[model samples]
Structures are given as structure tokens and as C-alpha cells.
Target: MQSIKNGLVFIAVFIILATSCSKVEDTVIHHPKDPNTTYFPMAIGNYWIYHEFTLEPGGEVPTGKIDSTYIEKDTLINGNLYFVYKSSLSLQWEMIMRDSSSYLVNYLGEIFFHAKSIGDTIFREVNLNPLGDTIFAQYRIMHDGPDQIQLPAGVFSVLDATNVQLFPKAVSGPKERIMNNFYAKDVGLVFRNYFLYGKQHALKLARYHIEK
Candidate 1:
């Protein structure tokens, strides 16, 4: 009788542990920057706060920096990168006339955002400048589940401001881009740094939910 009782207790403990572990695995956490759209496709028309820039070199590790705080919006028109903002024409003119050897080009373009899957994460990409041979930025937002969007909590911000002045410091005023995503609710959006140089210098930056 004593042996039978001990065996039963051991089996009960094993079941409890297994159940606990399963529960932990099933918990879905939401991110803050997630657009809050999950069932069907969602068109994101809200203004985005442009904050950081990630830099990559030819043969070194990628780095990120926070240089400016500008707000902009993207308009979605028939799945096109369509939107416009003010231009720093004076600066562009100065560069064109004053510095003939300048590699700086004023960026004044639109964005068209779409949804795509990377592994298990649902992300949306915004084409910052989708024309010509211009170097533009892209954003990616991640989701937690089919109906929940997680905010940035454990996400770290890169604080290297010196990078913005590497070249002639090309500025094109405020700009906006249209973003569309199916994971708008679950996954907000994503911003990726593609090392035009190599993958060894690639890095990613994101904004998720934080429990403050």
C-alpha cells in the first residue's frame, strides 16, 4: 500500500510539471508598436515617428544611432509607394553647385508597406525610398499572436549620433511612406538594416511593448 501511494504521488508531480511547462510555452506576449490588426489585411495610415538610423560598413559589425526626431506619414494608393513631403532644395542646390565631387543626394521619396513572413514572426516592410539607386530605409513590425500586438519593453535603442555626419549630411526635410500589413494587429512593423556590404554587417532594430 505504501509503495502504491508513493508511485501515485510521483506520477501526479510529473503531470503537474509537464502542464506548467506547456502553459509557459503557450503564453503569447504582445508588442507595443504592433499595429493592432490581425484577422485580415489592414492598411496602416497613422503617422510614424522616425527616430533612429542603423549604419553598416563594408567589413565590420553593424551599428545603430539615434540622430533625429521627425514625424511623418505614408499614404497607400493602390499598392504604391506614394506620398510626398517638403524638400530641402536650397541644400541640394548648394551641394550640386558648391561641391561637384559630393556623393550626397537629397532623399525625397515615398514608401509602400507590405506584409511578409520571416520564420515565425509576422512582419511588415515599408520601402522608404523605392526608386532609382538611392539608399533608403525599411521598417519591420513584429506580432505576438493572431490578435495580439506586442510593444517594445526589452528592446534597446542605439545612441550613436556621430554617424549622421559621416558624409555631407544630406537632409531632405520631412517625408512619409504608406504601409500595409496583414499582421498589423499581431505584428506592428519591422525596420531592418541591410548591409549592402555583407551579411556579417547586418543588424535589426525594432519597437515592441513594454510593461511600464
Candidate 2:
């Protein structure tokens, strides 16, 4: 009886340990084997310059401008490492991102872009408010395929990832926002198009420097 009781206790302890380990494994976020293959490569000193333009109201005429984005540095946040990103553009000024094999995720684990196994419809939610209440933005991957694009920098083969934004119920504003980002392998974002409130804003890659 003593031996049997000891065996039973050992079995229970083994079960408990296995369950705890499974839970820990499920919570682990796996990093990619090769971060360079991601749509947006994150590394300090890598930079991209864009020729930004906005269509004139009720017309197709473009107001020529310029903008730039670069990886400033890397920092540890919430126990995870993320590359710091800065841009001269207004809409996306600063953000921290990391590659997670199939997706480029932000500090909150919200996907910034899907990198692999893309299907017809991939969706994610962005929290506009810190508490994740009241305000949110819905993003849907509208396209993922091969295409070619021309820009001031050069012409190249590219993979297109278009994201459409759906307005949140708590927000009172324009109902439509669409952003299209074209990324070339090795190089980062080559071109982008943003449409909102009857105006179209475009950013065409003018120059870039990617560190090996």
C-alpha cells in the first residue's frame, strides 16, 4: 500500500509539471530564423527616402514633396527586443517592430504586416487607446501577390501588401481608409498609397540604403 501510494503521488506530480510546461510553451513568442526575409527589415541605420505627393482636391494633380524613414535603434520593451522606427511622414511617425517569422509585430503583438502564408483575407485589430477600450482600428489584408512597381529610386519586382482600414464604432470620422505598401526582397517598403477623405497620398521610393 505504501509503494502504491508513492507511485500515485509521483503520477500526479508528473501530470502537474507537464501541464505547467505546456502552458509556458504556449505563451512563448517564437522569433523568425531569418529576419531579413520579412517584408519590413528592421536594422539600425537602414533608411528609405520617398517622394511623397498628395492629389489636389477634386483633381489628379500631385503636390510633390519628400519624406524619409529609418531604423533609429533597438530597445528592450516588456522583455522583448524591438527595432525603433522613425519617419518624417506624419501619419506614422514612430513605432517599434520585430519580426516573428510570419508577421512583423509591434510592441503590443499587433501585426504591422503579414510576411508569409498570406491568404485572401488576413485581419488584425489595432488598439487606438492605451487601455484597449473605446477606440480601435480594423486592418484587412486585401492583396498579397507578385507585381512590379516603378519609382524615383528604381524599378523592381515587388510583393504587394494592401491594408484596408475599417473605422471603429466608437469613432466618428471618415468611413474609409486604405493603405497599400509594396515591398521588395532585400529592400524594404518601396512604395505606398494612402487614400482618405477623397484625397490620395502617395509615397514612391526615391532612394534607399540597406545594410547587409
| lDDT per residue as tens, model 1, 94-186 | 101010121111122211222222222222232234444334333433222223322121222111101111112236522322221222323
Model 1 Cα RMSD, 1 decimal: 21.2
Q: Please, what is the whole-model Cα lDDT of each candidate in the order they appear?
A: 0.22, 0.56
Candidate 1 TM-score, C-alpha based: 0.24
For model 2, how does the per-residue alpha-carbon lDDT over 48-105 read when each residue is reduced to its tens digit? 7766555554433445555667777999987778898775444345778887665767
* Backbone clashes counted, model 1: 27
Per-candidate clashes come to: 27, 0
Which candidate has the highest lDDT of all? Answer: 2
Best by TM-score: 2
Single out the weakest 10-residue window by summed lDDT for candidate 1.
10-19
